[model samples]
Target chain A: MIDPLSIFLLLLSASTPILFAALGELIVERAGVLNLGVEGMMITGALAGFAVAYVSGSPFLGFAAAATGGAAVSLLFAVLTQFLLANQVASGLALTLFGLGLAALFGKPFEGVKAPPMIPGPFRINWIVWLGLVMVPLIWWFLNRSRGGLILRGVGENHDAAHALGYNVRLVRIGAIAFGGAMAGIGGAFISIATVLQWTEGMTAGAGWIALAIVVFSNWTATGVLVGAWLFGGVTVLQLRLQAAGVKVPVQLLSMAPYLATIIVLVLISARQKFSRRAGGAAPGSLGQNFHALR
Target chain B: MIQLVPRSEVSTLWQFLTPVLAVLATMVAGGLLFWVMGYDPVAAIKTIFWDPLFGMASSYSRPQLLVKAAPLILIASGLAIGFRAGIWNIGAEGQYIIGAICGAAVALAAYPSEGMWIFPAMVVAGAAGGWAWGMIPATLRNWFGASEILVSLMLVYVAQRVAAWMAFGPMKNPEGFGFPGSRNLQQYPSASNPELIAGTGTHWGVVAAAVAVLATWFLMSRHIRGFHIRTAGLAPRAARFAGVKPETLVAFCLGLSGALAGMAGLFEVAGPAGQITDKIGVGYGFTAIIVAFLGRLHPVGILLAGLLLALTYIGGELAQLMLNLPAATVQVFQGMMLFFLLGFDLLTRFKIQRRVVA
Candidate 1:
């Protein structure tokens, strides 16, 4: 018989990476800029964090390094797409490709190295898991009640109007994007520093994209992100369990559970949102468009 | 009051010239990158751009160029069609894998038998495999409004693992002492995708790619469906009013793109690749996306773009061999292409204006 508590622990561990990335992306979209470079940033973080943790033998510091690395790269994206008014999608794709190449280059020497031990959690759970749980409510309260939060929502709602009201639209978006990058970095670090406890090529395994989808599935809400992460975590853990049980299904087929589940849930939520629009709110206006300030 | 000057419209000449211009610009950018990497930039560029076609080793490398370009062109042509309509199918790599597996399975079913029907059956199976893989996302999008991009891209990893499992397990050559691959298709002449004329870099894939270019050109320029795709991309609402069903277009684009990608994989397995192995997928799917965009999502343009990209692959390899450049230099070039393409494409969509707030 499968242990429910073990499953819960596995779910918590799996959800940490998604939680960190989705939360960051949520804050970004809330600021009216759609940056699709989360995948790039996360991978970059994975390499940087892994390198740090591997060399220094401290996973915590590795995570800190990852967040800083991810944020720094994200700032480059911010400068090009935000300040230079470059197309968001293209810039994001460039970032992903650039990040992948750069990671491959920097991580050539560090390939196949064992990662340092993870910072232990309460009762067998890691601290990142606890941090993920804490971040959900933290993000919720900040989005709803904080002073800077209102300014971000204002920009997302209408950049022109927000600027008309003398709010620093560019500054707010850049900060949000940078924060999103840091969060994604932390998410990437979780993979190397916590879950795998090892570094490998293309190690993020599309987790960043999954996190992006989760943000949409959650309808840009915090608690929804937590729920979405758990759901994905469950699917992933269930697949691994099925494999261990020597099920008749092909391991390849079983491995598809997470991706298939993501597609299904994403479609389900999209359908719900589409149908619920009569009562449901719309996606923020001015989303994904570059804003130009004529000075 | 602040004065704003309207930017001039880019002419038709610039429209066609931009891709060529982008290539030159990429060379300059790539050169600078090479210079930073400590290699003589000029030598690296020549070894990459010129050596594969006209260098002393051109005889060997030149044939390889067509061999590589054939599948990329064939697959990218299909993707370019959908991309033009704003339908994104990023799962070509998955489709390619499925196609190779299914096609090779067909050939294996006729194992050691001199069956003339084997090659034809494999071709159909390959196309079917790709079409089926593509329909997963297309059907979901049609039924439940899913994001095809995510579904399609996710399927790639799934397909990859499936390929790995097959190579190591059920599909493993029992006679070959625990090897993680299947019987070589090249050994079965009846099942093989033979070159039309040997030593000319000709294959079924090259023929298919050329045919695809012509077909797509006709479809996009003359067909009503083409009009719908273009209209839908330009204005989805207007296209809807014009009686184009968004769901139907999504399925058609995804399905067709998938079929072509599958065909490319099949041809590779039956011809150049010669087996169903773990290395069946070699980043062609992702690279094809770049080809679709670089070609500006036009069929004829994709043909040129495919060859150009194929050149880089061969050239990058040449550079690596001759100049000790990194293998990822090609990817860096591709990144620069998209970076420049996106930046330049802005001219087609929006006119720039300068103003000062008083």
Candidate 2:
């Protein structure tokens, strides 16, 4: 009795948040900065979006607030990693822990409160869903065709070379990190305002981490991020369907499909990259390395 | 204007001082946060940092420190080794859960059997389960160049689900109607891990933690493998030239950490926690990462860091009860501690010089 079209629609909606977050991470990674605090930023966005939408009665304002909240959180990461030269991994993890705690603390008032209604688009879908879809090609164009994009890739590929070429590495990376944070925030808002229609502590769950894995699964390509997100979305939708159909398997085991799939896909991609003898399978040259400008 | 100048050689003194500085900074920042939240910051800070050790409730909270710190020290010790070699295994929580499940499975299967062999067998099973879980990422990274951080982290969610399933399904208590959790191991004499000294929280876990600290100190300071780990992290190509295979190091570090985390879980399930429940993995694994870093990845330092963090946990609870602060305030304090720690770490490698612009 499961309708294929409805399932497709559900998958599309489900994939939008991850697509948005992964696309943002994609750009950040391409710029040679690995921000592992996507989860933190997303959670902050989720609460902010939900709280704002509830108060202002406009989902758009909520999304905007969410983006700002996420950006602010990422700026902390940028300050620590970019300006202070803290270890990127540890800084990012700290950001996540901080964001989660902050969100939980802030979200106390909004818990169990309903989110505002979403604005429908042409296909009876939320406007943000369409925005996420349009962003795919837009980001692809930005990363591949734009002049700024080339400079970013150049910075990622060789920060020293880019520096020698007179490109501002720190400024470019800070912008990229902020944009990634904003995107992650929007993605998180999608979960709160569009999908779940409510705010809950730790509700973003592992979606941020999943987005991180999807970036790797996509091999650092914008188009690949879309495919990976949709694939994961389909798995999630199908798992829910199986659970709804009174499947005998434990619900907990069924919930593990998406994560297991991520691990498996990561293994396959990594193996292929190994056999091909390429360094990091299209990873940015200076990914995760902090750039310190010397006079 | 102040300008940061990179130091030619890493400052040994700053390395030891940064953590202390970070802690003091966190106190100031945390107090400010509490004040902003409309609480008496002084009283709140005292309850969290001071009262836990010497306050009116010190008698009650003192024993809780060892109880809470035991697992942290155990897991952080293992995590520190892998972290030393740049092998990030963030999924220790998942391994910890698997270890607990496996250990509990051993105890549950041998129900009513009064034998001394049961506890030892459970411990072995627990370590093996954790080792196997840890191997997945190690093998993947070794053979395929996959990032262990993401893969291992993903496994945490999966392990959480598995733990939930165990609580609801096969491991559910049989004689206690339809409750979700397994039988209380605390009441089960054959499998129970009791406090050796009453009111002190001195259990086998504490003993194991002490042993792990000593063992790790010996290995990191005196062992050739430890030297190899340090070299690999500092200079990968140099380590390779020195005949250190990256794959072996990855496996060794991951396996060792997983085993240690697994032991922590085993000890926890067999002792204080006493049952397999859905909420058993209470983030000791993640917090251990903080302990590892705060300890500067040193074994002895982790012991002290573990105690300090445990103080926060106890003090946080005390704050929640006394000052009506949110439970998450402690989490925020811990996060800020890490943030300040990483920021302060900058001072260790660089010195600020006033810029002279003509």
Candidate 3:
């Protein structure tokens, strides 16, 4: 029988990566930029973090490297979308492809290698798990109560109007993209360094996509994202428990639970927004639109 | 500082020139990557681009190009239409898998039976299965306002699991010591999609891909529906005023593309792959997206782009054998090509001018 507290602990650990990624995406979307390369950046971070930690014998340094690596990859996207005025959707897809290939090329050496063991925090959870928990409230405050957030929301709602008010729309978006990349990096590192304790190709295995789903499920709210992440995490942990207990269900069918749950949650949220006669959906006005400051 | 000025009219010359420009830029960037990785850049490049066409092994590799490009062209032909109509159906991979499973189910059910109707029946089942899978996101988006991108992508994971389930459980071969794959269709004459002309790599899939190209060209250029699709993409309000229904366009585009992608899967399984397995999808669906963009969403362009991408696959393999390059090198080249393609697209839509500081 699965113990209640142990299962709860597993849920928290399982949820941390998506929590960090969704939080980062939240800020980026709030700033009116849709960066769909979270998976790419996360994988880059996974390899970099794992390699750095292996060489230096410190998981903290590995996490730092991951953040840096993720941001570096995001910069390619920023240049393409912001500076070159490329289509955001295509550019984001290109970034994912590029990052996955780049990581695989570099990660060849790291294959079959164990990541440096992570140190547990006060509650015997990994330190990064605690960090993800703390970041939820912190991000909530930043998005809901901060001046910078107001500016970001303004830019997202109406870039032309924000530009008229003398805000630097491109600058704010660049900053948000970078922050999103860094957060995604940490999340990816959490997978390699804390959870899996090993480096493997495609190890993130669509967690980044799941994170993207969680963002929508949260209705672009930081607190809502927390709930979405936990919901997903709980499903994952329970699925693993069922597998370990030798449940009669096919493993492949059992593996589909989290993805199916994401689709269901997304439909439920979207249905409510559609049928409830809510004033307006919480999506930022200028989401996915390219902005060029034309006078 | 440089400033971009929007062109009053898109430059026809730039439209034709940018793809070539992007290719050159990718070569340079890829050369740099190869150099940094401690390989002889020139040799690596030559092995990938030149050897596949003119080298001693060209006879063997040249025919292989058609085999590789058939599915990409078929899938991209469908996708390009939808993309032009402003509907994103990124779940073609899932649709493809479902189609293959459905098509293979027909054959599996008629195992050891002889009938000319088997292959045709499988094709219909494949397209229907794909169309059904594609409709999920279209229906959800129409009724519930869900983002089709996320929903379609989510289904890919679901489809993968379903494929795995079939491989291990219901669809496993009854013979051959309980192996987790179905009976090979290549061994079954009625169910097989063999190369029509030996040494030419011509098969039913290749023929289907050619038909798709011509059919989409006619549809997009000579049909009223195509006009509505273009109008909707350019201006939704104007399209509405012109009597275009967004829901119909969404459903039509998604359904059509999903059907094409499904046919590609059916062709692949019945031809090259020969059986249903957990790992049937080797990312043809995703790669087709790149092909659609690289071809500039044009039918003729897609043909050339599909061939070019097929060349890269062949070349990448040659390089892997001769130069000891990583298997992922081809993936990197494709990604870089797309990056350069998008980056260079700025030139096609705008005129860059040097800013004079006042």
TM-score (chain B) for candidate 2 is: 0.98
lDDT of 2 at B260: 84
Q: What C-alpha lDDT, on a 0 to 100 scale, does residue B202 get in candidate 1?
A: 87
Pick by lDDT: 1 or 2, better one: 2
lDDT of 1 by residue, B134-245 (tens): 9999997777677787788788888888788878777787787877898888878988888788776888889988999899899899999999988998789999998999
Ranking of all predicted structures according to DockQ, beginning with the best and ending with the worst: 2, 3, 1
The C-alpha RMSD of each candidate to the native structure, in angstroms, is 2.8, 1.1, 1.2
Q: Chain B alone, model 3: TM-score?
A: 0.98
Writing each residue's lDDT as its tens digit, candidate 2 over B1-358 gives 8899999998989999999999999999998998898999899999999998999999999999999999999999999999999999999999999999999999999997889999888889889888888888999898888889988898889888988999999999998699899999888887888999999988888998999999999998899999999999999999999999999999998898898888889889999899999998998998999999999999989999999999999999999999888998878888999999999999999999999897
Q: How do the residues A138-222 of candidate 3 rate in per-residue lDDT, one tens digit apiece?
A: 9888888999989999999899999999999999999999999999999999999998999988888888888988888888999
Off by over 4 Å in 3: A278-280
Q: Which pairs of residues collide in model 3?
A: none
Q: Quote the lDDT for A140 in model 3.
A: 86
- When summed lDDT is taken over every stretch of 10 residues in candidate 3 chain A, the lowest stretch is A272-281
TM-score of predicted chain B versus true chain B for each candidate: 0.95, 0.98, 0.98
Ranking by TM-score: 2, 3, 1
